[model samples]
Target: MKNLLDILSNPHKRMPLDTLMKCEVVLEKLDFKRSEGLPPSGAQGKEQIFNPLLEVVNKCLQSPLANHTLKRTFGSTLHALNGPEIKNLPPPAKIAKVEEPPMEIPDVLQGEIARLDSRFKVSLDTMQTLGSEGSISLFAELQSARLPCVPPLQVFVPRGYPAAPPAASVARAAHSKPDHFLKLLNKAMDHKCARLPKNCSVGQLLDAWEMSVRQACAPNATTANYAPVPALGI
Candidate 1:
C-alpha cells in the first residue's frame, strides 16, 4: 500500500502492465471489504466520514475500472463522504456556441444589386450572395404589387451568367410552407429579349421570373383582373 501511494505521488513512476493489473485487484478487494461499513446504503453520520474512506476514493479513481458502473457507485459514496466540503472543487464553465460569419458581396455584383434596388426597388433584404463569384438569390416578392407572396426563391447563377438564362425555385419548407404562401415554383420560365432594348445587364436573366410574377399578380394586371361591369339601372 505504501509502495502504491509512493508510486501515485511520483509522476516519474510508470507502472508496468502487470503491476497496474495488481493495483486494480488490490483496490477491488479493499472496496469489497469496506463497502459494508459505508452508510448502510442510506444513513450518514460521524461514523461514515473518515480518512480510510477517502483513501479508498483515491484508489477507486486511479483503478482501470474508473469508467465502469462499479466506479460510479464509488463516486456516489465519495460524494456522500465529502458532503458540503466538496465546495473545494469549482463548477465547470460553459462553452458558448460559435456562429458562421456574415456572407460576403463581391465588387462586380454591387452593380447588379444597385440596379435592382434603384429600378425595381428590390434590395438586399430579398437577396443573398452565394459565394465569392457574385452568385446571389433573388427576393421573389412582388414589392410593388399587393398580392399574396410566396417564399423567397433562390436563383442559382453560375460564375458566368446571362450568357444563358438563370433558374429560380422555392426554398425548403419551414417544416411546412409559410402562411398564404404556395410552392408555385419550379414552373416553366422564359425571356423577352426580343421586345426589350439590348445591353442592360447579363444578370437581368435572374430577374425574369420575378418580373413575370409581379406582372401576373398586380391588382390591375390585364390577365388576372376584370374591368368593372357597366351598372344596370337600379
Candidate 2:
C-alpha cells in the first residue's frame, strides 16, 4: 500500500506491466477485505473506507504522464468503491443562438419610399440583400375604381430601380380572377413603360403600376392576349 501510494504520487514515473498487474490485485484484495464484514448497506460506508485511496487514484487519473493501464486499473477500483453513485457526470454546455442584423434601406430611395407610403399607405414587409443586389417587398392598400374591396397590393422592388420598373401583383384572395388580373396589369405596365422616356423615376413607375392595376380591375375589364413578362428580380 505504501509502494502504491509512492507510485501514485509520482505519476511521471512509469510502472512496469507486472507492477501494474500486482497493484490491481492488491486493490481487489483490499475491496474484498473491506466488504467481508460490512452489512449489505449503501455505498456511504464503502466510500468512507476507500476515500483516501480514491483521492490518490483520482489525482493520478488526471495526470498526462500516467500509464494508460495504471489509469484503467485505478478507474475500476474507483467504480468498485463508489458503485453506481459515481456515475453522475457534468451536463453538456449549451450553445447560444445568433440573430441576423436588420436590413437597412438605401438613403437614395428613402424619400421615394416615404412619398409612396404617404400616398398609397405602403408598409415594408421584407428587405434582403446579396452582394451589391437587393430587393424590397411591401404591401400597399389600393382603392382602385370599380373594385369591390380594397385589395392589399404586393409590390416587388428589384435591385435596379428607376432604370428597371418594379413589378406589382394583387393578393390571391383579393381578386376573383387573380391570374387574369395579374396578366393584364403586367401587360399594361410593360406597354406604358415602353412608351415613356428612358430613366423614369421610381414614383413614375409606381404611378404607372397603380394605373395598370386600375385598368385591370375595371368593371368592364377583359383579359388581353399578351406575352408574359418576367417578374422583378431580387
Best candidate (score: lDDT): 2
Per-residue lDDT tens digits of candidate 1, residues 1-234? 444554544535555556655656775665444655554533544434433544655676678865773433334444555674534667788888876556564455566656554334433433453344455544433354444454554554444444433344545556874332141222212223222333335345435545555554544544223233221100
Candidate 2: deviation at residue 33, Å?
26
Model 1: residues with Cα > 4 Å off, grouped in runs: 1-87, 117-119, 123-136, 142-153, 158-166, 170-188, 191-202, 210-234
Instruction: Summarize candidate 2's per-residue lDDT along 1-234 as a digit string, tens digits.
Output: 555766776656555566766877877766544544565557566456555665676666567855885655466555655685646678988888765556565565678877664456677774434332456676777554455344566766665665565665655563366566566766776666565555555566567667777777776766554455544332
Worst 10 residues of 2 by lDDT: 126-135
TM-score of 2: 0.47
- Model 1, position 154, has a per-residue lDDT of 54
Cα lDDT listed for each candidate: 0.46, 0.62
